[model samples]
Target: MSERVGAGKSGRKKVRDGIEGAKVVELRPKQGAASDKAEQDSEDRRFIHRDNGIWRRKGDNPPTFICGPVDVLAESRDEEGRNWGLLLAWDDRDGHRHEEAFPRALFAGDGNEIRSRLADGGLTLGAGTSAKAAFLEWLASLASEQRARSVTRIGWHAFGGQSAFVLPDETIGEAGERVVLQTTEREASLFGVSGTAEDWRREIGLMCAKNSRLVFAASCAFAAPLLGLLGEEGGGISFKGDSRVGKSTALRVAASVCGGTPQNGAGGYIRSWRSTSNGIESTALASCDALLPLDEMGQLDPREAGEIAYLLSNGQGKARSSRTGGARSVARFRILFLSTGELGLADLNREAGKATKAGQEVRFADLPADAGRGMGLFEYLHHEDTPEAFARYLRTATGQIYGAPLRIFLRRLADVMANEGEDELRGRLRDRIADLADDWLKDYPAASGQVRSVAARFAMVAVGGELATSYGLTGWADDTPSYMAGECFHAWLAERGTVGRREEEQAVQQLRDFIARNGEARFERWVDAVTAAEAQSEIPDAPPGERFRTQNRAGWKRWVREDDGKSAWRYLLTSEAMSEALSGLNQRSAKAVLVERGFLLPGKDGKIAAPISPPGHKKVRAYEVMAAILGSDEGDR
Candidate 1:
């Protein structure tokens, strides 16, 4: 099949060329670092360049040949239709045939001229996008093929660097063992071999059956050796599985070997602000360069995922500080492994897809069979049968430090936090610690000591030393709080004569009594008490009819009558009275309230009740004219 390339942006062209009779080779890079390296390699493979470098298969055989790392260049026209500088190209390798047309057309710049303008840097690749997506997929496919051992053998060359030959375990036997084990250190797996004494599968199955812990340890050791294949700038691994399959343990071993922290050692970057005399300083990922073992990979917070994704894509450090301007250049690292449990296959697919897009290598570790069938994965890790064994394991792992900066440098790190002011820095640091706890650490102690070793490698210095170390502040020594507390709890159990004892009946009664008392009282109150408010208030006040004011044509005449030798009368009336009087008028007429309030007047037909304007036609404003003006002759009376 003709492999597609450059799905998103036209960053570069995808050239298809034959390697020993039309074998399609795809080169791509993960997110973060310059993916253009992948594009350059891809172009070199497509068209046969005499001086180009690539891994070529000889005579369609299983074995592959390591070719040169060649330069690729693209020719494009400027706005005015003039040919511009060579946009992108792979330079010719030494001791290879150089095609005149390919070099002349593509690499037109003088070697000296091109070399002079450069200050020891080449063109960088942009972020992961639709255009560069095809390259990402193709690279992932190639890695997957190697990981699955689909091809008989593959030669991998580090971009801008050296090359190595990778072959299946079937072809490479262990130096000392009667049988070889077929397994990847970069992956958490156990394969079964039926026949060959040189099969890696047989060795792994034996180690797992004798002690899965050894298998876990070996997996970590293997990953460490393969770190070089991960390369600089971009690339990482993700360990995925349920609790207690030794995911963290594997990476912890890797960290111990490499001398990096478990928490910050690998995976992504952690952003923090440091206080200095001038102001606050910030550090990202904190110079962590070791195996990262991320526990509970399933439940990461959105922000952490974003931070991890960013680092994986851009190879740029990210840090945000209020005291400082904003994001300062932070250090970036790769994910060594991610550990999780009880995640849906769908969720795993989504997460893996995202990691692949960001150029990350992720492996899903299944729960160990022996542990899985016995007492569940988590229970097996903490089983009391091997207390001394686990403790000793922890001591050995904690003694080793990885990726920790020198003491002198840490003071500067402290200063960065100090400049931000102790309180602010401490608060953020606490929050960061808390996030790691909720996201990864909660299920930690339940993980195997081997996995714990990996986690300890990537953890923060304070946390790793204080919590995970046997020689540090929170070690298993008699003086340490955790150790003392565990000892005290064990003692208390012994004092109660509860060692291997069953108190099920007493516990059941206690539970029943507590629930009957507290639970019933709460339920009664909730059921009996009113739960909603009344719709209306009960307070008494004036009726709407009595509080309303009346008016007439002269002005705002009150609804009062003058006793000037005549019956008491109203100059104006309340709406209720008006309606009642109109009903008793004894005449057929339609009653109309003024659209707006107005003074009473004679009739248009000139009848006394046929309202008409007063003679002078003196009209006050509508509201004023509507007044019920009542007058009296009290003096004459």
Candidate 2:
């Protein structure tokens, strides 16, 4: 046993071994069982405590540990109700940072899933027999005593203001500088950087000179960023025509203004119409406050075409259920999309034996691609080579110089809005559109309401393009866009015909077609005895009887008779034959309409039919239409 020692300044005893020369050392008091247990409890409390899936440090203001190379930007649930996290991660090998969605289960999972995901993302956990164990060990090493700062949570839908310009990896603003966020792991690699402002102007100027549609589409793309500021419901425009007629090229050109080319597939700016409504809703949300270009309208299911159009234009998604049976947040967007297809939306549905609604038709206006000048989608090929060659050149040139114009345009628009306020800018744009619409419809007074609406949409595109030019984003002659717009608008009007007169014209054409088809076969002759004698007899001085003779027919005829002491020629049609000829029209309603238009005379009992006696047949009821109502022979044709 050690010998008892004297008390030291610390009030603890100094102990000495039994050996005489052994140096004395201070000895601590032997702790009681309760004290030892208390110490043990304190030590146990120092370890991290996890509650409700969140890890918390033990000390005051303890730090939260998160691994690098990947950060969870948002949390969401998939269609099947599985927990998901939108992650912004870096890939050092490719020097590209991408946003990927991963299962939350993997992060909390027993190592294997996490390791597999990391490996799939091109990350290595070093040589280890147990990758799960290694990953866990590595995650543990990230823990530190430093306090963790709060991270800004980015919403999935980035709409309203410059925030809507957020890309997969960065947020772009009016300043033309990237607003570097915590989740921005790398610079934007897809859009690259904006070329010199003059480079964009030159390229766009060439497009403007080449095709009015191209200029219209490009301007729409540039003005898309201002849509949110415009404070109006969002809509889209479609470029529809035959395949390989430069429709796709125009869309690609428009896409180049924003970022990415037409061929970038899913990751690029262009999307396919082959997706489901939900899929498109997601795409639209991703493209909020930007240009969303969809390719191949023919790819969509005919049954869903109308609904899809309504959904996209309305900027809302279907509400869904979550795993817990609660309502999931519906996806929303405010964007102007550009669509390209070989067939127009209505024609596409018609081919599939599906009918399109009027709302769908108005939402996506169908303009004839042939510009009515023998040019297919282009009036003149501005490039030295053929249109195809120019398209190929554009594919490469556009990819090289993307994203800058949109950035600069947004910056400039923001500056203007900041200085003059949003209302002033929107009011100016509205006034411009109104003025353009008035000019476009000046000659189309009888245009249908739908036609006028479509014209307004075209005018909007025109106004948007012209505004971009006026803003100096596109280097073109100031009047070039307006001229192109007017030309396109007129061409559309010419091909579509007068809108308001469509129904009346259809009625008239139907009547003419019926008469032309059956007039000679269906009706019998109704010549008076005296007229018949005169027609059969040869006059001595007459030159083959050149004077007009009333030769009656069974189905229709024109007869000149004295009425109220005035000679008038009455256009007559047998009631039975008229009913068969104009079967599409309601006989009573058509007669009333004809009477109102002065086409027919109302007889006794307010009926349009009159009693007529043939030379050798029984009396018959015939419709006596006025000759003046039929107009000239040229008008009938």
Q: After superposition, how far is residue 340 of candidate 2 from its true place, in Å?
A: 2.4
| TM-score for each of the candidates | 0.23, 0.61
Candidate 1 ranges with C-alpha deviation above 4 Å: 1-218, 221-251, 260-289, 296-299, 303-310, 313-335, 338-637
**Each candidate's lDDT (Cα)?**
0.28, 0.58
How well is each residue in 1-637 modelled by candidate 1, as lDDT tens digits? 2234445223222222234344443332222233555544544332222333333332333323233333322222322433322222233323332211011122233232323222122322223343133222322223211111121112221211222222212212111211111111112111111222222222221222223333333233223222222332322324334455544444443333223333333122111111221111111122222233444545553224434433543334545564567754353433233233344222444464321111121122222322333532222333235534443443344333322221212233234433565456445544543454334435334533323222222222223222222222111222222222222222222322322112222222222232233322221111101111110122122112223322321222222222333211223222333333333222122122221112233344543243322224343222111212112321111
> Runs in model 2 with CA error above 4 Å?
1-164, 173-197, 261-267, 324-326, 373-375, 383-385, 501-637
> Deviation in angstroms for 109 in model 1?
43
Locate the minimum summed-lDDT window of 10 residues in model 1. Answer: 526-535
Model 2 per-residue lDDT at 531: 46
For candidate 2, the per-residue lDDT at 186 reads 22
